[model samples]
Target: MSIAVAVISSDTEYVTRMMSYMKGSPIYHTWRLQLYTNPERIHQLTELERMELIIVEEHLHSSLLRRLQAGGGQLDELVYTSKRGAIPIIVLAAERRELLEHELYKFQSVSALLHGMQQRYERFRSGHAKKRLVTDDRQQTIAFCSTLEQAGKTVMALHVAALLASKGYRVFYCNLERWNTSDSFLAGRVLQEQAASYSDLLYVVKSRQNASKWLAEHAAAVEEYSFYMLRPFQHEADRRGLTTEDAQRLVAAIAESGLFDHVLVDLPAGLDDWTLPLLQQCHAHYMLLLPQPGWQRKHQLAMSCVERHNAQALEELQHKRLLVLSEPYGNCQPGSSVSDLESLPYVEAWQQGDPVLLGSVHYRAAVERCIQPLLTGEKVV
Candidate 1:
């Protein structure tokens, strides 16, 4: 399952350092690295040892490119064959300089170099490679949204993702909220040196590039929770500039990537150009409602506005929408008017000032029951 990579560099010392770092890093388990101190030895890559990626030192890049263009070797055959063609070539420079599409600076940390290589390979695969075959059982996309602030939509979304992952399903949790707070609850935050910002991923999506590869490369695993999650947006403008088309394409790429069994999206309150498409694209929409007065009216107004813009989208939302009453603070009793609707029980631990409410077993069990019908494809009674 490891991705094959070959590095050709005349700098013996640099190659040694890189090999040492790879041996000590977690990436060693995911990538197979082959080092070559002589550029001519690259021809030794036979059919038995095909490389998915090739990295050339700046001094040897030109000569390698020429040889590749001239053709007639195992390397040439590997790069030109239809079945495994379009293997990516990356150039590593000694210092920061005007870089080409696949060129990277060499003096950076090994982690950064590996991250850059993964990003380049994914872009090449998404744009130049053929599409992968999708199976009959397509991945399901679920959205958690609410019109009221503090409605616990994100809390519910994370719990559902945890439950699904525990049940042996691969889950990718995405937070689309303009101001995301999921990080406060999740474990294993990406190291600052290894972090890939959401803005960079958004730019790839906006350029009409497939986001599946980006997700595959950058999605951080929440090992403590047993699910994967994309980093939240760091800036306001980046989230604000997301278009309806961008939203649709991003969701479609993740759902169709064949990487996960379920895609859980946490969305901001209200429907606009950005959120409308997402709401329409999801297989099921879980709308969290607070027990406070007038919250239902606000949701109705939001639906009415969406209807005015796209009637068909409104119809789709109505068809798949599930209303959940969130009573996290114990403001309402079980026998209240909203009792018929699916309700999340109030956990006293949260009221007792537990910061890590996401780990609450009682709350997660309630969310599991609320989402069980959708997971089983059964109608909610």
Candidate 2:
């Protein structure tokens, strides 16, 4: 299938020249391209076609981002609204980058820049779907979150939960990603009751009734990994309407029910409004940083906000905030002060739904160092 891509750039001259010569670019035959020098046209594309990749120029969303400034909305709200501003949205900047914010590849010639962009397009198409999901009973709840798209937060959560289950820990990996897709079918398909979904789960949690019966009767498992999995809500608004109270009641009841040893939560990239308060109650948090400054900054900000709001979350984050760094592009400098875990090795098994058992040297070492300690009967911290 041809990858559907939208490329937005503010520089007209660059767009003009590239549009003239792009037919010769490597992806002309293998992919479909839509070009715009303005971001406003995004709404048009969003309504017309489903984009596999969205590449927008830096500063295109500047006005929206202004919401993050001192007089505007706070960072979390800014990201919540903008959908991706928690990380300095990637930009096309020159060599000398500020705090390396708005970092982009610079080129002496337009051809070189286009080539780099094309390379990114190819890499993104090939590896983007590679992913996180969870929290625990042996210990307590764990959160998997990232600052930006394609940062492997889902992959880490799923792997950890699966690995823990492999060792006989009763684990349930839950997805709260908001965007509804049946990706869980890859984990395990269930003979679901037509009404089985977040809507039912929400009612059960909010009413404080019938959860044990519902879970026993309807819960599904990703068979080989031995961890339970839950799909997202049937309707988008159902998830959007989920409140902190709703999530808190749901996760708390699940964790305290003695049905499993741990519960792993797969959170959205920008902490959705619903995820904020539920976050305050988590026992441990993992912020996975891709090899980009934008990603690192968002991961740190997520940690900082959680700490500031919840005293207990802060204390645990101080000791258990997991900083996972992916392989570096050059030399990567992660600035978080919490405990650092090892970098993840990209395993081919991940795309096949078997990453839980991907026993790469670095992955195994990380599970032992970071997860083993919590698999006992104690909350992290």
Q: For model 1, how does the per-residue alpha-carbon lDDT over 292-334 read when each residue is reduced to its tens digit?
A: 5566567778777777888877676786788898986776654
Displacement of residue 139 (Cα, Å) in model 2 is 4.8
- Reference-based lDDT, each prediction: 0.72, 0.58
What are the models' TM-scores? 0.59, 0.52
For model 2 the local lDDT of residue 133 reads 21
Q: Let me know the TM-score candidate 1 reaches against the reference structure.
A: 0.59
**Over the full model, what C-alpha lDDT does candidate 1 score relative to the true structure?**
0.72
Model 2: per-residue Cα lDDT at residue 308? 65
Ten consecutive residues with minimal summed lDDT in candidate 1? 127-136
What lDDT, from 0 to 1, does candidate 2 have?
0.58
